[model samples]
Target: MMHLTSRYLISLASFIVLTSMAVAKTNPACLKHLGGGYGDAECYHGLSADITADNDKLYRNLRATIPLGNAHQKLLNDYMASQNDAIKYCELQRNAGAQWKAEHDGSMFPALYEQCVYNIRKTQSTFLQDLLKMANWK
Candidate 1:
């Protein structure tokens, strides 16, 4: 059951990231579509998905640099484990958001949460990119 759940989550995450990736690549920039709330949310969600995909690709590239061995297999396994761990992170994010919404009680909660998540993903993507550079990968 646990394995199936992780597999499902991975598939779902892949679908989302790949789906948004196309729009994300075309824009390059998530230039805020202001006035319309839907547009701004789209910007945040799209950019977040893009950054998530970027981080995944960078880590995969880093792993690829390692020759096939026990260590390589371990890295591959760790990547899947990390994806499973992301479910826990999402739970934490929701809990924190609930607390904040309870205190503030505004329409901005959803957008603010999405923006915060985007920032976190962006940071992770940048960090992964730096790691790739340090490894001399293109």
Candidate 2:
């Protein structure tokens, strides 16, 4: 009885692990609609890194541009605003993904995923441009 129970436990654990992996690896149908694949994953990851770097550069540039009273204070305010906007954008993407999945099923899943990634990158670029402009302003 003890041996049987141990075997069952191991099997259950294995099953759970496999299920989790499948869930994680399976991209949402919307992602497919956007054209997401392994390449999309790579692109998104790289874009995320670039966004981080650009944000840092924006902060530095802002510091350089505004040497007036409490520059650091203004920087904090701007950074917080940008961060909040980014969080909101991510939430929008999550909701959009769910809606897309319900409407499209799994058809063209890769294309959808790619489009989602592209949208993210486009948003990031716009955000960075705005930040840079603010930093450059007099």
Best by lDDT: 1
Model 1 accuracy (lDDT, Cα) = 0.65
Q: Which regions of candidate 2 fall more than 4 Å away from where they truly are? A: 1-34, 68-76, 79-81, 99-138
Q: Report the poorest 10 consecutive residues by lDDT, candidate 2.
A: 25-34
lDDT of 2 at 29: 41
Give the distance in Å from residue 4's predicted Cα in candidate 1 to where it truly belongs: 47
The sequence of per-residue lDDT tens digits that candidate 1 reaches over residues 1-138 is 999999999999999999886564525455634443555556776777777777778878877766778576686567546653554454355447667334554344555556666767777677667766877845
Model 1 residue runs over 4 Å out of place are 1-36, 70-106
User: What value does the lDDT take at residue 67 in candidate 1?
Assistant: 72
Q: How accurate locally, in lDDT, is each candidate?
A: 0.65, 0.57
> How does residue 18 of candidate 2 score in lDDT?
95
In model 2, what lDDT does residue 127 have? 68
lDDT, candidate 2, 1-138, per-residue tens: 999999999999999999886544333343344344555554454445555555567656655665568667576667656664654454345446567344444434433444455565557557667866876777
Error of 2 at 61 (Å): 1.6
